[model samples]
Target chain A: MIDQTALASAAALLGESWTPWLVVPPGLLLGLIFGAIPGLSVPIAMAVFLPVTVHLDFLSAVLFLTSIFTGGGFGAAIPAVLMNVPGSSSAVATTFDGHPMARQGRHSEALGLALAASCAGSALGYVILLLVVGWVADAVLLLGPLEMFAIAAWGLTLIAVLHEGSFIKALLAGLLGVMIGMIGMSARGDMRGTFDSLALVDGIPVVPALIGLFAASEMFRLMRRDYIVEDKELRRPAFSRILAGVGMALRHPLVVARGGLIGIGVGAIPGVGAAVANLLSYAETKRRAKDPSVFGKGEPRGVIASESANSSSEGGSIATLLALGIPGGSATAVMLGAFAMHNVTGGPRFISENLDLVYAIILGNFVQVVVLAVLGLGFLFFAASLVRVPLRYLIPGVLLLALLGCFSITGDMMGPITMVVFAGLGYWLREHGFPVAAVVIGLLLGPAAESELLRSMQVSGGDPAFLLQRPVATAVLLLLVASLFYPLLRRRRRA
Target chain B: MQGQRGSEVALLLLIAGFAIWLAQDAARRSFSFENLVLMVPVAGLILLLCGILAVAALRRAPQEAGGGLARVLGLLALLGGLVAGLETIGFDAAAFLFLLAATALLGERRPLVLLAYAGIMTFVIIMTLGFMLPYEMPTLLLDPPR
Candidate 1:
């Protein structure tokens, strides 16, 4: 079952001393710090380290990447539990429960619990990743262009519908992102909208666009603050605190399992990635909680569900990336390039031939859990202190990081240019209270929806009922329509 | 800002403008139309209507002036430092300088303290990212002696 060649290679590159014990905690801890920091996001951290992945063996490289991801996922809980700002999009769910707990001076408990659930979720994801790739992939292969389109449309509509404030505003932001997305060499024959800059030819790199929206805007907004990161309570978070965290997670296994399943399902979908997965998972936790009313002001259960599901989703997402040449998310897309650099071709046939390598990847993740558990504790302790860093000091530093992060993406000024422009746009929108998440979601779903529409056009020969003619596409479109419109309808009735 | 209630009222006009822009451009380039793009102005018009409705709601509420000129200018200068510093001095040189200088501008004043924090942080970042990870920074600028 194992590729002895890859297995021996993994053991060697992971280093004789770099057992799962050493590898897991630090990797988890590093990711948590990245996640806990207000503006330092998982994707930014991933891109910064992407070049390094090229230098390592395939499983070892993915192990490192996933380690950063795991750390970052739990890291968001720190800020949410402390400062009320979610470190990453996925952590938005964490804030529902984590923040209130912090307000109640249970920051330690909230952070610890989120960490435990996150690790549990990651462990479960590894199990699924190891077992499901060979058995269930054939079932999923039936997803056609129409199904993909419907799903993508459903995703876009869901994003637009679910955003805070005006539904119209959310859709507007999405429309703008789609316009920005259209700026590069689209699959269509027309040069589209690149206005002749060679930089625009390949389309905008998702990392830079994301950096501009999330990282740069965050930095700019924080630039004038004089944040004083308050130190942790001198009493070190006790082992008892961690034990309570474990109890809380297991007690609500239902919450943890549901979140993990969301992560896995979202991971399996093409185009939709962890960001969307975590968001939908959080929304579901909010929708179905025993105390749905307790959500949003800080609910520990909300944090646990979101944190666990988001981290768990990673293994499944990567499984899709490894087993199908198809990408499940942005991180996986980047990993694909990394895979090429390492001379590893990941696809169904590749996985079948290199099952050991696949197992090694899963095995490496299991090793990550110990690291994740230990570092999760470390990050939990530091989370409070990180929030105390004065916004003023943090903002300028982040802006600089954002710009630098952009340049590091491709080693060019264009990255910074994109960052500057998008950030300025962000500032303009921020003044109006527009949600940037809406824009990111729209941009992500745009090309897929557009391409699918193109397919429908070709198949229908321009029939007016083109989308409705196909059952799968119609079902998806209907789901999308319902997802987007339901909230508005509900709100209207409430008013 | 008039809450741009008129702007909201005129949202239909704005959508019409965008519709013309997209449709005319698509025609000029002979690109296939998605009709989904048509959703843009329609949505915009809806937003305009909503924006108009919100104007009354917003007026009753007060707005905070977010920041001042000094801060805005400072942010612009810091953004420039990102462009100029990395290219001029390199990642370590530029990063070290940018963090130090920008933090000072952002309000941190103690020289030795700022430099100490900046230097150690820069070194750690460079070693971790550049040496350990091999990320490509502006090496053309920083490849000089450490």
Candidate 2:
């Protein structure tokens, strides 16, 4: 795999890259814009731009799409930090500490940390890919339905139990979210809880629900404040502050490395990518932290853990896409379409024949990481100005953008309606001390857990002993049990 | 303590009721391995958990700080009306009106600033999203029906 011939071919490809350099800037910008926006995700941008890629050569097209992928990964975290609105679902965990850091007048540091970690993670992910793509994909395939259920269960439990509120209430909120996720028609085509609404047939759209729960609800809570940050002196966007943040992120090398490794492991598994990786990494980082209480209250490590994991997951997803010819999620699925457009297939055969192309793509991602850091810094200089906008303007403007974004998503009233409804519900839930993060995660992961459990039961003829078959599932189950009980035990010991 | 706890209990009861309703709906289907398979089991579990949580919540005092209840309610009402008015008044008109109402509701008292902000926001939205993006939102003023 590390042959001189392959290395020379990669170098040649890099040297002969005609307009690939030209496409990189626009590709990253397109990704950043789409990712920063509320509803327009990386997949949507890639899907829309995929057709244009047909006119370009294969290498340039893949390079352009992946640049968007890399840019969007970090771009999603901006709104998550500043507004508690995850521009994409992958950034949901980023909001846990990122928003608190913003509220504490540390928004620049948070954004900088996220950017630095993202660049580092992307570079590391591709390095791992350049070494052992085959091993990563094989490991990912071992994660069956049982293992998925355990992972989802672990995430929900951790999110609920780790909150500063009443544990039971958090659990209730999480359970309610899962129930809401099961609202549409089930896998068997039987309607579960549509309540006679035709829109319920297709299930509640996650993006609108997320915008409602996080952004609109936060906007409502923010109506009392004049500005997001109360101290007038700390509101301006400063390049020095961002550099300080970058320095702080560079100081914590271990956290970034751990997050990146977790991302690669979880992201390679199909149907579970950055969405789960960020949350899992954050939870794990907090669990191992010296002072876990600082996690949701502006801890820089939280942002580092989340951003690195989500960013690194891109490499793992691409590994699965190339080596196994399996797309890990929607973004990679769009890349698969790009593959089709170029009349190329990705599998073992492609790997055997075109080892140089694989190396070129990975090498391009490494360059993307460097380009993203420079470009992302410039973008943040402008984005940080958002904190300076008064609440009165910010509230309505963000809400309007969210409403229109939702409309763009559903192409009907359903999107806006779901958003407004969830906004009110989310506000009430937040007032009652329910962990909205738990609810959102539950909503996001519920469908996967449900389907996995159903599939497990189907495979085992509805026997509870079916869980005993998978060793990985058993180990995860044990870990889940420990996670649930360990916190209560510690509380009791403190008392 | 009692007042906050009462509200918490009520919320939990509502959730429990919803869970029960969901379970009942799931039960309406046959117990085939394929149809409504996980729905009944999951709904039942949710109902049980909601009941347990409701009992637990009833015994606790809420410690959350929520001072802006009225503001939250007001904004929600405004957004509700904005959604309802979108198709009739169109995206541009409805958005401009909603911004004006929202800014005022959120304590922006100056008329000129409000007008300027609303106009600029509406223009930017129409130009960027309405014209630039491929989204085909229903609009009366900007994108009239053929």
The candidate that wins on TM-score is 2
Residue range A158-273, candidate 1, lDDT tens digits = 45334566655666667666655655555565555556668778777655676567656555665544442233452245556756766787788887888788788776776665
Tens-place lDDT per residue, model 2, B1-146, is 55566666667777778877776675675456655555566567667766786767766666554577677788898899899888878788888899999899889899999999998998778667765456566666665322
TM-score of chain A of 1: 0.76
Locate the minimum summed-lDDT window of 10 residues in model 2 chain B.
B137-146
lDDT of 2 by residue, A369-434 (tens): 899999999999999999999888998988998887888778788989999988988887787788
Interface Cα RMSD for all candidates?
4.6, 2.0
Which candidate has the highest lDDT of all? 2
Which residue ranges in model 2 land beyond 4 Å of their true spot? Answer: A1-4, A196-198, A462-469, A478-495, B1-6, B32-67, B132-135, B143-146
- What DockQ does predicted model 1 obtain? 0.32
TM-score of chain A of 2: 0.95
- A454 Cα displacement, candidate 1 (Å): 2.3
Q: Judge candidate 2 at residue B67 and give its lDDT.
A: 71
